[model samples]
Target: MAFDGIVVASLASELKHKLLNGRISKIAQPEADELLLTVKSTECQYRLSISADASLPLVYLTSKNKPSPMTAPNFCMLLRKHISGGRIVDIWQPGLERIIHFTIEHLDELGDLCRKDLIVEIMGKHSNIIFCNDQGKIIDSIKHVSAQMSSVREVLPGREYFIPDTMQKVDPLTVTSEEFAAHLTGKPMPLAKAIYTSFTGISPVTAEEICSLAGMDSSVPAQEYSADILLHLYTQFEIYLSAIKEDTFSPGIYFDGKEPKEFSALPLSHFVNYTRVEYDSVSEVLETYYSTRSLITRIRQKSVDLRHVVQTGLERNRKKYDLQLRQLKDTENREKFKVYGELINTYGYNLEEGAKTLECLNYYTNEMVSIPMDPLKTPQENSQRYFAKYNKQKRTFEALSVLCKETLDEITYLESIQTALDIALTEDDLAEIKEELTNSGYIRRKYTKKKVKIKNKPLHYISSDGYHMYVGKNNLQNEELTFHFAVGNDWWFHAKQAPGSHVIVKTHGDELPDRTFEEAARLAAYYSSMRGSDKVEIDYVEKKQVKKPNGGKPGFVVYYTNYSMVIDSDISNIEELE
Candidate 1:
C-alpha cells in the first residue's frame, strides 16, 4: 500500500529500460487528472499512464488501452504542443524521492531541437504533473497550487520548478551513518517511524524490515537503542538503499489471509508471517495488488446489506434459543412432581383428616419421601392438586422441546448463511445469497419483482483422483447440490455437528479412491464455520443415506450412519472450475 520513493525508483528503472530513446506516438487524457502516453520503443508499444489524483496518484506502464474523449483537455493540448513525437532521451529519478523526470527532445516551431522536462511528482494529495523547460522554469501543471492554498510552495507558469524541501529529509541513497544517527538523537517516536521521516524514499514498511534485519524491535523508541544497535540498524538501512541503487527490486504483495494487505517494490521481511506473492515488475505488483484489493473491497461493500440481514436473523434466533433453554430447565423437575402425586395418593389412605404432613416410601428410588398437605382441604384433594401441577409442567416441557429445536435450527441455518457471505467473491454470488434471504422471509423482496435468475452456481472442483466435487455456497444451493445434482451413491460430506457447506463428490458407481475421500473431507472443512480451526471433524456418507425430514429447513438432513475423518481446511491445491 505504500507507494513510496523506492517504488518510484524501481518504476524509473523500468521506464528507462522500456521508454528511453523511444518516440512518443500518441498522447491522450482519458481523465482530468490523468495522462496516457503511447511510446514506441525497439519493437513494442508501451502505454505509460500517469495519474495525479488527490486520492490515488499513480504512474505505471500498462498494456490496457483507454478510450479518450474526442476533445483533449487544455493541459493535454499543452503537453502535445511541447512533446508530441518527442524522443525520450533520458529518464531518471531524483535521489530517492517519489518523482520521475522524463527528458524529451523534439523539434520546436523554429525548426530547432529543444529539450523539455515532464516531471511527475507522486506526493499524496500534493502530487502533480508539471511540464518545464530546459531552464527548469515551469510552463504549467495538471493541478495548480496557489499562495491561497499553501505557503510552502506555489506551482505556476514562469516560476522555477523545484521539489519542495518541506520535510528537510535527507537522501537515503547518500546519507552516512553519522547523519542517520545524529538526525534521530532525541526523537521519541518508534525507531521505524524515525527512520522513514528522517530519510526520503524509505517507507515505514522497509524501515521495520531494516530493524528486523538488525534484530531489533521497530516499536521500541529510537532513544532507547544503544549506539551499537543504532549503527547496526543504519547498516541494514544501507543494504536496502544499496539494492535500490543497484536497481535490484523484488516487487511483491503480502496477504493477510486471502486478502492482499501490503505491497512494496522491495521484499518485506517484517511480513514473513503473511502470504507473499512476488512479481518481476513493479507495475505488475501494483496492478495486481490494487485490482484484487479493489475487487474484494467492492464485493464486501455490496454484501453489507445481506450481511446485516443475516446477522439480524442470527441475533434474534439466538436470543429466543437461550430463553427456550431456560424455560426447558424449569421443566426438568416435572418428573419428580409426578412421583410426589403418586406417593400422596397411595399414602393418603392412612392419613387422618386435615393432616399437615405424611412420610412414605418412594418406590422410584427406594427412599422415603415427605408429602405436605393443605390443611383446609382433604388429603385426596391435595393429591389432586399435585397431579394438576405435574400435568401442566409435562405439557410445557413437551411443547418447549419442539420449539427450542426449531429455534436452534434457525440459528444453525443463519450461521451457515453468514459463512456463505464470507466466501462470497462475485456480485452474482451475493445476489444468490440475497435471493435466498428474501425467499426465506428474512428480507423483503424489492418492489420491482424481477425474475429470479439462478446465476450463482455451486463451486466445482476436481480432486486429485479425478473425482468431481461440488460445494454449496448457501443453504438453497446446498439442497440443490445434494438432491438435484448428486446421485444416490455420491458421497456427501459435511462438518460434524457444525454449520457448513454440503459437499458432494460424484462417485459414478466406481469405487472411490482414498485420496478423493480426503479431498472431499477437506472441502467440507474449508467451507464450514470452523474453517479457521486446524482440524475439523467431517462426516461423510452416501447421498442416499442422507434424508430430508418432512418440513425441515432447506439444508437440514438426517443420517443415522456415516464415516468420519479429521482434515485440515487447506484448499489451495484443489483445482476449482471457474
Candidate 2:
C-alpha cells in the first residue's frame, strides 16, 4: 500500500534492465489518463503500462493488453509521432523521489536525431506523465495543470518541467548523518512522523520500520530521544538505505489472515507475525496487491445494500419484541380479575336491593374483601362483565406470547444473515444469502422462468490432526451442511447462543483428537458475530444429537446437551482449502 520512493527506485532498476535498448513498437491510450506501450526488446516483447490516474498512479511492466479506442488521444498521437520507433537509452529515478525518467533517442519529423524524456511522477493526486525535450521543456502531459489549478508549478505545454520541492525534504540517499540527526531533533512530531516528513520517498510505514529496527518507540516525539538513541536510529536508517543502494530488494506482500495488508520493496521486519510472500518481481507484487485489495473493497461496497436490509429488519423486530413483552406483562393480572368475578358471585345471594357495595370473606386467601357494585346492575350481571374482561385479556396474552417468540426468532435470523455477509468473500456467496432472504420474505424475489444456480460452497479447512472441517457461510448452507452432507458420527460445532457458521468436523468413525476439537471451536468462533471478542464459548456435539425442529428456520437447530469450550477466534494458523 505504501508505494514510496524505495518502490519507485526498484521499479526504475527493473525497467532499465528490461527496456534499455528496446524499441517502442506501438503507442496506445486505453484510458483518458493512461498509456500502454508495446516495447520490443531483443529477447521478448513487453507492455509498459503508465498511468497518471489521480487515485492510482502506477508504472509497471504488464503482460496483459488493454483494448484501445478507434481514435488515439492527442498525447498518444504525439508520442507516436516522436518516439514510436525510438530506442530506450536510459531509465532512472530522480534522487530517491517517486519519479521515473525514460530517455529515448529517435529521428525527428525533420529527419534529425533527437532525444526526449518521458517522466512519470507517482505523487498521489499530483501524479503526472509529462513528455519533454532534452532541454527539460515540456511538450505536453497526460493531465494539464494550469497556473490557476496549482500555483506551485504548471504541467502544461512549453512550461519548464521540474519536481517541486514544496515539502523541503532532504533526499535520503545523499543526506549526511549530521543532517539526519538535526532533522530528527528539530522536528516537533512523533519519531516515525519526523523521519518520513524530513526525507523524500520515505513513507510512514517505512518510518515505522526504521524505528522498529532501531528498537525505539515510534509514537514518542523525536526530540524526546537522547543523543545516543538518535545516533542508533540513524545507524538503523543507514542500514535500511544500504539495501536499496546495494540493489538487494526483497519484493513481497504481507498478509493478515487471508487479506493482503501491505507490500514492500524490502522485507518488512516489523511485520514479524504476518505472512510474507516474497516475489522475484516488484511489478508482480504491486499488481497482486492492488487487484486483491480492490476486489475486497468492491465486494464490501456491493454488500452494503444487503446489510441495510438486514439492519432495518433487525431494528423493527427488536422494537416490536420489546412492546409485546410489555403488553404480555399487563395480562399477568388476568387471574386476579377471574377471582373478583368468583367472589362477587358467591356473595350475590346476601346482597340487599339496589346495594351500592358487597362485603365478603374471600376463601382464596381467607381475607375480608369488598367488591365495587354497579348501582343499576345485579351482582350476577357484574360477575359476568368481570368474566368477559378476563376472557379478553387471556386471549390477548396467548396471541402476544406467540408473536413475541416469532419476532425474536426473526431477529436472530436477520443477525445470522448479517454475520454471513461479513464472512462473504465472493459474488456467489452473496447470491446464496440473497436467495435466503428472498425465501424468508426479507427481500422481494425477482420473477424469472429460469432459476440461476449458485455455486457457492462451504469453507473447507484441515485441522492440525488432519481432520477435515466444513464451515457454512450462510443459513441455507448451514442447513445443507448439517443435515444432508454430514453423517451421524461427524461432530457439529457452533458458537454458543450466537449467530455464526455451522462447523462440521468429519470424525470418519474415529475419535477426534483434542487438538482437532479446539481447532474446530476456533473456526466456529471466528465466523460468528462474536469474532471480535477475545474468547468465545463454543458448543460441540455429535451430529446425531443436533436436530432441526419441524418447520423451523433454516440453520435453526436444538440439542439437549453438548460439550462446551472457550477459545480465541484466531484461525490464521488453520489451513484452509480452496
Candidate 3:
C-alpha cells in the first residue's frame, strides 16, 4: 500500500525540521526518477533521497551513495546552476494530497535573495518534479506533460503552476458520522469498499483496519449493518482519524497464515490472528520495505546468468543419468535370458528333437532340471544366439555403470551450485558464485586471468535483544565465520533443503536464550532467496556439529542433531549493521 496523506504530511514536517536553513552542498541525479541532495546544516550533514518513480514515489533519508551520469542531463545542469548554494526555507504538502513543495532561498542575478519552489508530486502515473519561479510559472520539469498527456491540465514551460482539479473524494479527516452513514446507505458496497471509495486519503489498508477495530466484517454489505453496528463503526473510524491528526501511528505488517496480507498504519481485520509487531515510526516502515525490496531486486538481477548456467548443467546431467539407467536395466534382462538358454542347450537332447520344453533327471546328482528353447530352432543355435546377446549386454552394462555414476555425481554437484545461487545476497557473492560455475564449465569464460582473491566479508546483524549475529555471504565467508569467527558455544542456522548463507550467533561464550534462537532463524531465513515465502524451515545446531561436505558446492554443508523451526521470513525485526 502507498503511504497515506497523513503519513506524507508527517514526513514533510520531520524533513522541514531537519532540512530547513540547511545549505545545498551537492546535488546529483543517481537515477532517472531519483534525486539525491546532500545538505549541510549547522548540526550535521544529511543525504536526502527523493524518488518520483511511478511505481513507488518516496522521500527519505539514506546513507548510501550511487553513481551518477557522467554528463548531466539538461534538467540536472539547470538545477545545479540555480540551486547550488540555495538554503531550504520551508517544506509543505498540499491539503493532504500526494504533493510536497520545497521553498528554497537563492540569490538572483542582482544578488537579491529570492524564493523558488520545487514541487514534487507523488501521485501514481502522474508523478513529476516541477521547478517554478517566484511567480509560480513553470520553468522546467523532469517530465513535461502537454495537453496530449492530460486533457484537464498541461504541465509545460512558461505555463502557470496550478494544481489540477480531479474528481473529489470525501476527506477522511473532515468526514462526519452523518455524512459517512449517508454515503454507506446510498451505496450497496462492501464495508471496506465504502470506506476506501468515500475517503480522499484512506487506503484499502486503512479501511480494512477500521473495519477490524469495529469488529465488523470488511466484506459485508455496508447497508446491511444495524444502527448499533454503524454507530460502533463510526466511533472506531473517529478514533483512527484522531490518531492520524495527533500523528500517533504504529507501523506493522499484517499477516494471514504467515503471508503478509497488508502493511499499514493500523491493525488490519483479515489478519486478526497475527501477532501485532510494532515499529518506532512510519519512517522505519518506509526504510525497511524500500531497502529490502531494493536489495532483493539487485541480487536477482546480478545472479540471473549464474542461475541459468546452473540449471543448464543440471538438465544435461539428468538426461545422461536417465539414459544410463535405461541401458543398465536392458543389460540385466538380456543376461537373465542367456542363463535360461544355456540350461536348455545342455539338456534339450534328452527330449524330442524340436521340443520347446523338457524335464529330465540329472545322472550325476539324481535331481531334475527343466529347460526351454525356441521350438523352430536347434538347441545349439538358440544357445549361441542367447550367449551373443548376453555378452553384448554385459559389456554395455559395464560401460553404463561407470557413466551412470559419473552422471549422478555431476547432477549432485550442479544441484548444490543451484542452491548457492539461490542464497546469494550481494554482488560480490554473485561474482564468486559465477567464478565457481565458470571453473566447473557450467559457465563459459570470456577471458582467462588469474583468480582475484577478495577478503571475505561477514554479514552482520544486531538482534532484537542486542545480541550480535554474523552470516556468511559466500563459501569463503562461511568457512571464516564458522571456523575463525565463531567459538564452540556459538549457535548456527541454515535453511533446510535450500541453498543459503550460513548464519552464526556470537554469544561471547554466554548462554543463548530462546529469543536469540528465533532472531537467528529470522536472519537465516531472510538472507536466503526464500525470504519472501510464507514459511521457511530453518535448522539450527551447535557450531561444532556443522561440517562442510567434501567436494560440495559453495556454502554446502551437513549437520546433525540440530533443532528446527518453521518461521516466517520476516526480517522486519532484525537491524542490519551499517
Question: Which tens-of-lDDT digit does each residue in 1-578 have in candidate 1?
Answer: 66899899989998999899999999999999999999999879999999999888999888889999999999999989989999999999999899999999999999899999999999989999999999999999999889899898889998899888998999988888888898876678888889889989878787888888888888888788778888988888888678787888888888754678898888777775566878888888878887898899899999998988889888899989999999999988888778888888887888887678878999888998887778888877888888888899999999999999889889888888898898887888898888888888998888776876767788899999899999998888899998898999999999999888999999899999999999899899988888757789999999999999899888889999999999888776678877
Clashing pairs in 2: none
Candidate 1: give its CA RMSD in angstroms: 3.5
Candidate 2 per-residue C-alpha lDDT over 26-123 given as tens digits, one digit per residue, 9 for 90 to 100: 99999999999999999999999999898999888898999999999999999999999999999999899999999999998789998999999999
Which ten-residue region of model 2 has the weakest summed lDDT?
266-275
Ranking by lDDT: 2, 1, 3
Q: Candidate 1 lDDT (Cα, whole model)?
A: 0.88
Error of 2 at 525 (Å): 2.7
Best by lDDT: 2
Error of 1 at 113 (Å): 2.9
User: Each prediction's TM-score against the native?
Assistant: 0.87, 0.88, 0.70
Instruction: Give the Å shift of residue 10 in candidate 2.
Output: 2.5
lDDT of 3 by residue, 1-578 (tens): 76777667667766777889999989898888788889998899988888888888887777778889998878878788888899999898876677789999999878998989989888887888998989999998888899888898788999999987574577677777788887777778898988877777677777887898888898998889887788889899988778667766666755422234445665554664454555665566677666766786788887887877778778878987998898798886775557656666667666577787667555545677565567888877877877887888888988888889778867766765665666666777788767766776667778648757654477788887878999876655676788777877889898887656789998887888888889899778876656667689999988888887776555556786889999877666567795
**Residue 515 Cα positional deviation in candidate 1, in Å, after optimal superposition:** 5.2
What are the runs in model 3 whose C-alpha is more than 4 Å off? 1-4, 19-50, 53-56, 61-91, 102-118, 131-140, 157-162, 165-168, 178-198, 204-235, 249-292, 321-375, 380-409, 444-451, 458-472, 475-578
* Candidate 3 colliding pairs: none
Model 1 residue runs over 4 Å out of place are: 166-168, 181-185, 222-226, 255-258, 269-275, 339-382, 445-452, 464-467, 488-490, 506-520, 542-544, 563-567
